[model samples]
Target chain A: MADQPTPFERFIQGILPENPVYRQLLGLCSTLAVTNGLKPALTMAGAVMFVLFSANVIISLIRNLLKPHLRIVVFTLTIAAFVTIVDRFLAAYMYQMSKALGPYIPLIIVNCIIICRCEVCASRQSVLTAAADAVGQSIGFGLALCSIAVVREILGTGMLAGFRVLPASWPSWTIMVLPPGAFLTFGLLLGLVNWIDAVRSRKKL
Target chain B: MEQQQPDRRMRLRSGFKNSNLAQAWLVLLLALVFGSALAAVQVNLGHVIEANKVNETLEKIPELVFGADAARKLKQRQVPIEITPGTIAVEKDGRKAYYKLFRVTRDGTPAGWVIKARGQGYADVIELLIGLDDRAQTITGIFVLEQKETPGLGNNIGTARWRSQFVAKSTDRPLVVVKGGAKRPDAIDAVTGATISSRSVTRIVNRTIEDLRGRLIPAKIEFSERHG
Candidate 1:
């Protein structure tokens, strides 16, 4: 019991040690689908943050009441409701951005990251602890999406969010913006994060 | 194992009052609450969402009629562009397909025509607002209104460079998509690796121009073109 991590430690680990994308490999569908451009990736991250944080808080509050068999059902219903509201809001207010994101916003329901966090942290932990976990995981997810977007957008279009970051003459790599670019970037970044983790652990030993 | 704990706590013989026996009440409660929330959202925001789509197409009218740079100048100078919406039933292949038409005029003069057209693309329906000169003799521009084609490949149909091929091409001949560079008149170069998508757009534009040329001679178009 004494060796148990503090709530803050649990929160802190999600950012790097238990990153949903790189560390746990959860929510890769959106990570790959939206990372071709920076704007869409950021928008997706924002929506996910809102949904994940809200779901975590509500689930943590009602943890004791949750039936064992009906737990997954509740998570799905809650998430679907949040995602529907988000989709409509985006369509109404941020129409262009919503168009760019397309069906990916609705697809956030199946993102595994939120569900995994709910089961692992919110279902057992205090409300504050679950919230901290949500925030931390959201940041980690955002970072992962941003990194992939930056790499793909720069190499693919020689631009970031419509601004030309590279020279005009730069021949953009066609593959970088394609769906395969997502897999390529994900593989390399995953390797990089793992390698860094290994070095830090080896140093401690 | 966790399911057994609920059965031990059940005191009521009737299943309705007992929380453990009536395990699905929580789900029913959550569903009702969430469903109501969702219904409220849809009722309030649904119209705005539909309006957003219409407004998006309206905003693209300027760039579709005039060139992009000219469209910017028109905005700066406060040149009022009028878009009169009308629908035209054009016979496509074997069936009758209707296309929404926008007769655009700058101030009091007929500038060009923009037609809303859609066709089957590689993965999904691709909607385009195609622009043509007042006489419907040549294409002015094209703007993709909605598309869900393959990312990075078929979706390039929306890019300015690819769409530029249609501009100034004569309406006398149906447009043809070529493999590489299209030096021949009435021929468009296909988007590399997206031949199907490229062909789809070409088919849509060609079919639209052929059907519209004879039908779109508005009385004001000729009068306005001759005088101003």
Candidate 2:
């Protein structure tokens, strides 16, 4: 444990051992809300990555000096700082996208993935480890988001990324874009992930 | 008991000095830096963001009205007026544009006054925007902006075939949507499946005119005198 970890170990740890969305299920709220469409899901993923990476590095650099009781508050303020920057940038450059995202962008501040990484990975580890951990979690989050969006877009609108994938004669299901669709799709996906993990664990045993 | 108490106090003080105080200072310092940075970015981008919003609105208005030139002409003289919670009247260049409350300006200015109208449609809430002749309050044109009726049926309020009904209608009498073609001088044909939408638009237009009569008449008189 004292020896510094290799780059491969850092990368593999994020995707497998500490997978933020799937294995840990840390940041499910935004994963569900913004994954209704491909474009929004991608944008959200990108924003989360930026905040996670930046906050993790900053937190790691100062971890030793941080008091234990106030650590959570410190992590929140750091994450919030990054989220605000992302939100303001989106509003200025991509006004329509920002409007469509609405409150979810600001809500990124409370995302457990960012806080969790700051606490578990950054608070005790080196800056490099923190950065790698943030990147890994971000990738896991992105994969989960896109996976949900792909299902919703295909079934709801008969389109993929706004382009029609189904035949012209196909009848589009309006229900897919509605609230019920989100809950159903997410639940099924969650179940599927759990089943896969269970099967994998059985094979290993 | 006395010995135990001293030991406990020593542990507590050590914990406080080593971890709690350091954590507090670190968090405080980070917060100060982040807050100031965020404030600086917001101040820098605030004007650009506002300008983008206005530009987006300006772009959408013309398309919604089906004529970019007409929308621009209207913008030149448009004065903002609020009618209800989510509705605004834009008076521009001798014409009026009425839009829903969602489009209202922050300062309570009408986006542009075209015309203000409401009527019973297929389901509920049929609002219309009719461009007016700034001087005569005569209907230059009209566009239906919103309706809650069935789609592919009642949503044709924005279609050309039904909207052509208002082309030469007098602003004098209230317009009506009839079963077939309008036999009267100011009637428009009701859509076959969308009778509700058609009727709603007609009602909205007529109701708007009724509502605007007092304001329109005085505004016209004032404009004519100023120009003349």
Candidate 3:
């Protein structure tokens, strides 16, 4: 299509227009599941970013050798391999965090963000471009997760990263820590992003 | 010779209508190669994974048996475990669930017992470690090992505030879960939205204590006394 965007533009695009979570809606399962607290949300984001970066670099380097008929198969195999490495590494090094994450780490195998990046960008672009996109999209996805976690943790427990934020006099909202809270906060944040975009486009016109 | 037909060369073509055997073989080969690579990694990391798992359990033992502050006291002491030959059976919903009990000693003296317990919770089997005092008369602490309960509701059983209720609870009678509020020592307040899970945990802890007390504790006490 058009000439590839500069790396800076690509990074910006990932955070706004083509965000894997909020804009593209690629990896909603994890986006919703792990954002209840700061630690889990951050860990999930790191795992996704690592998988995406590695998979993109490798896939782009070998894109020419990939046969059209076997492209999806190769992509999945590569993604699964990277995911396992991350899972084992976490279990060994960050034992408690690995335990806290539980099944979510292994579930990264099926995260659509990494697979989507491989198909859309990595397969068609240079290694450098693919790597840039991976980093950008990962930050976008991580930001979305962190935003939700910040709200939930503060409102639900009156704490942020285990430190008290709200005054003790303020009544904590217990529902904010539950499953429904995830949906409510995410929905509101998505709407806010859309609203801001609408205002920016109108000003441009 | 004129009547004999010339042999025509067959071109291998892969298209939409025709199946591509070469491509199929390539896909299979890719899968096989990658699968072997994954297997190799797993085999190499197998020991590390096993050791981490055992360490995870060992690391939680002291904290589960003692409060956070007191758990550090166990650092210098080697916590020896003595496993019992038989398992304890507890009935819930017409099914018999079995639990294993282990005696935990601090420096060759009996200090406590950590029972590996399980019960049918709301959605899945809840596994936990129940730590009891030396006499097996009071529960020192409880730690949930594994659970597949409802995320926001039943899963709250794993939180510290919920588990702390079991600390120093006497095991003379079966513990009960109270929905409104726990008014007595033998009763625990059920999690706000997860009555079934809270009840299940209490029942499992109570059953383990009942089954292990008579057979294991008295014999161990006599052995420790004679050794002293």
Candidate 4:
């Protein structure tokens, strides 16, 4: 068995070493689909955070009772329950944002990030440890989404959260608002992160 | 391989088939508990979720049916009425179609009607709210409620510039979509790259206006004759 990570280390791990979107590459569908605009990207991240935190806490509480054969089914039910709550709440309160996100909200049930955490951390760890991991991974996912959105929104519409950030005379890159822009931006950012990691390793040597 | 009898009675035994029965029962228990939890949440929040949906569509009715000036004036006196197609007109398939219309009154006199319309577009269904003048002779305005046209091209159907062109457009003849320089009074300019989407909206609006006019003109005539 691996040594129990310190709470601080557990939290930081999601943001750096095992970032859900950037490092682990889980939940890429939402990462690519909603990151065209900042508001939607953040709102999606918020929903994921809620689901992850609640599912982790619940699974950790029931860890002992989980049967080997029924484990996958139980984990799915727990994650799905949290997802339904988030989905209903968003539709009722923030109707416009809910509409903007559309099918992506329901797609959270299959995000893989929440289920992976339940299997890897919550199934064996204390509730507090599981909660810490959920928070850390969610932050990591949020950072990755926001970074992509910042680049896409700024270049696509020359605006940030609906406010004009660039001069009117500056021509907006129309491609940046389309699917191709999402692919290009994510590719470059992934390459940049990899390069940074390589430089850091060389420095350590 | 070990030979095992395939008997239902044996399978139900706890350890008869290597604990498969126990695993099945455990899964069933978990399923029941979680399913009920989801059902409970749904029941508690069903009303609020439904109301939000109605409001999302209701809020757009006035803006689409009345011109900006009259719509604002009539906003304070908006009355939503649900109508069945059979009540309004004879139908081929009474079960297939239903219409939601809004009655706008000013100073206790009926001012306008906003009717919802839907039809297939280039990529998906195009839903719209179309306004008719009280006389039911001309279209007052139009609003695209929902569409799934190709983004950056067909999606331009929802732009303010495109929608604004429908204001005060005569419904005397069926609406037509034109390429450029829509010189004809009944012709509308199609979006540069979205001819099919623009045509779809025009076709839907025209068909809806024809269907509604058949039911409404007689109703208006009878209403005025009795009230005047």
Candidate 5:
């Protein structure tokens, strides 16, 4: 077996090496839905960070007490509670954004990344390790979402962050802001990540 | 064994540890803990959320009634008008519909009236803030307060350009939606590929004007009579 990975490795692995969005492909529901705009994507990242981190810490604390059969229920209840807080917080403080994101914020309760982390890492790992893993995975998810958002927003509306970056004459690619655009961008980027990984491994050998 | 064994309750504690019901007890305890935590959050943030919804409508009042350009000019002078909210209940065919509306006043004279309304759209209910002129004979502007229509298609109903079609439409007759077939005097161009959303918005605006036109004119006439 490979040498045991410390908390730092787990943290770094989630960032790029084992990115939740690009490599693990967890939580793609949010990644696809909110990546049309940079603002929504970043907001989603902020939300996922809070929910994932809290859920991980709570699960790690209760790891010893959780029954094997009933653990999933406990994890879901904890995650749902955190998601509700986030949803309400956004509605209170950031009304426009909350309206724009609508059901997507509440939808985070079912987001695979949080539950998967609880089951795989937080269930057995130390609280510190689980916390680090949660942060790294969320950051990786943010990066993937932003990368897709930047491309889509630029091509879809000839703008970046609501400012026109492309020449005015550049015809907007309306399809890029649609759902198919998310799939296309994700597939191409996944292929690109794989290609780079393949070359790096070949050099190492 | 102890000289005096405790009651069955004490023995059951040890027995319960190995029983299947142990998990159920743990689940119940966790539910109680988490339920209270969620209740705390709702109580803390609920009012803020309510205020946010109200503030959004209040802030859009000027732009909804005076046209965007005039609203901007009014804001440059630090929003001189005071908006007082009131209710208008219109009965049709033995049914009552109550409207929460605002009277925008500057100094002492009323500037306009803005009403909150909602109607079913293609996906979900679309909420709107509709503005009317002083006499309520024509629409000055409209703003989509909330909608959950299809993204990139039906959602165009909220765009300023699409909503502008509702501006300056007379209340004398109901507005009609046209899908590039014919441009009549009272026809609004339905958003391409989103006729349902366009139609729903038209229906809502038409209903608002139809219900309030005569009622508002009579109220304003009374105010003018007193000042005349």
Candidate 6:
């Protein structure tokens, strides 16, 4: 248990124990904003994955050369560079999706999950290990976002991704698509995760 | 040993001498790289973005003027008017017939036009394409474009049933909206729920006609014969 985990273990930990949104709760603002629909959520998740993975590998490669005092500044600069690249790439190719996500895409620079991984996992670990950590964490983040989107989209519009999933008779809840819906959905999901963790712990005891 | 100690101190001082300046230089270099990259991207996409905006505006204008095929042959020609306010003028074969201008923006920008004899409907503002005969001050044909009132009650503005009433109405006299239906040559029926939207359309048409007779006819700007 004390030894470093294998690549597979690292990946699993990303979705559960080290979950960036639920377990770690490092970055939640963009998570809530983009989770209004499946498409926006998926796009944001992909952008975050790309930036996180690239930044981690680069940080690990230059860890030794980076002075301890200037480590935070270097890590931030690396993250910002990767975020800018992703932002521009999306704007050039997937212009519509970029417009839908708007300012949140660039705000990924301040996403603490990316910076945390750089400092804790990438800065000390090998490049391969850092890459594994990035992939694992990204998967976890994606799952969290998709789960929230599913509930919000279903109740808000009585549809799934734009396809009507609910019956015509069903009354649509307009509030689910608004700001309050984001808070309610996130709070409920957080509570459910905590409850499940507690029950599982009790069974073990 | 004492000489060696002084030499070591000199080396340590040299190592820390310009660290602040080096840090500042590093920051400046990174900023320059980022700034240039952003400028290049903006220059590349600027024209395409502008073209898309213009196309969107062109598409909306015609729909707001005349409904369907009537506006199909409509061509928009930008005319410079000295009124200092934005307005729309209708013409046929170089003679001005009908014109209307309204403030769509608070900053004095023209938002839309109301043409004479656009038709009467239940509710909502009905936009029209007004044209006149070369020698006559009266309007020839008024094509109804768009309206938003009540669906079943006010939507009659767009229907052929309510619109056909204006086919032969004389433009020499002002049009009026009546509760049951207009008995006069220049009157039309107003929908029950959408009386306000219907009245708004009638008022716009009347005002536009007045503007055409008072100002546009006397002005040097000539209205086009064909709608564009």
Give me the candidate number with maximum TM-score: 1
TM-score of each: 0.87, 0.69, 0.83, 0.85, 0.84, 0.59
Q: Is candidate 1 or candidate 2 better by lDDT?
A: 1
Per-residue lDDT of A1-205 in model 1, one digit per residue for the tens? 3664557987898888899999899999999999999999999999999999989988988898887788999999888889999999999999989988888999999999999988988888888988999999999999999999999999998999989999989888879988899999999989998999899999999
**What would the TM-score be for candidate 1 when compared with the true structure?**
0.87
Task: Go through the candidates in order and give each one's DockQ.
Answer: 0.74, 0.45, 0.47, 0.52, 0.57, 0.11
lDDT over C-alpha atoms for residue A165 of model 6: 95
- List the pairs of residues colliding in candidate 6: B67-B145, B74-B227, B74-B228, B75-B228, B76-B228, B92-B225, B93-B225, B124-B197
lDDT of 3 by residue, B151-206 (tens): 65788999999999999899888889998888898889999989999989998887
Residues B1-228, model 4: lDDT tens digits: 133565544656635444666656756776788789878988988888898876766666556655666557655565432211112433534444455566555455656677777899999899888878776787877888889886557888998789888888887789889997688888899998789999999999988887776566435322211110
Which candidate model has the greater DockQ, 1 or 4?
A: 1
Give the local distance difference test score of model 3: 0.80
List runs of model 2 lying over 4 Å from the truth.
A1-7, A201-205, B1-23, B64-210, B213-228
Query: What tens-digit string does per-residue lDDT give for candidate 1 at B97-178?
Result: 7777788889989899889888898999988999998888889999888888877688899999999988888999999999
lDDT of 5 at B108: 66
Q: Give candidate 5 misplaced runs (Cα > 4 Å).
A: A1-3, B1-26, B72-80, B91-98, B120-122, B173-196, B217-228
Q: What does candidate 6's lDDT look like per residue over A61-141, in tens digits? A: 876666666678777877887788777777766765775687999999999999999988888888888899999999999
Models sorted by lDDT, best on top: 1, 5, 4, 3, 2, 6
Report the candidate with higher TM-score, 1 versus 3.
1
What is the lDDT for B118 in model 3?
A: 81
Off by over 4 Å in 1: A1-5, B1-10, B13-17, B20-22, B69-80, B92-94, B106-110, B178-196, B217-228
Reference-based lDDT, each prediction: 0.87, 0.71, 0.80, 0.80, 0.86, 0.68
iRMSD, model 3, in Å: 2.9
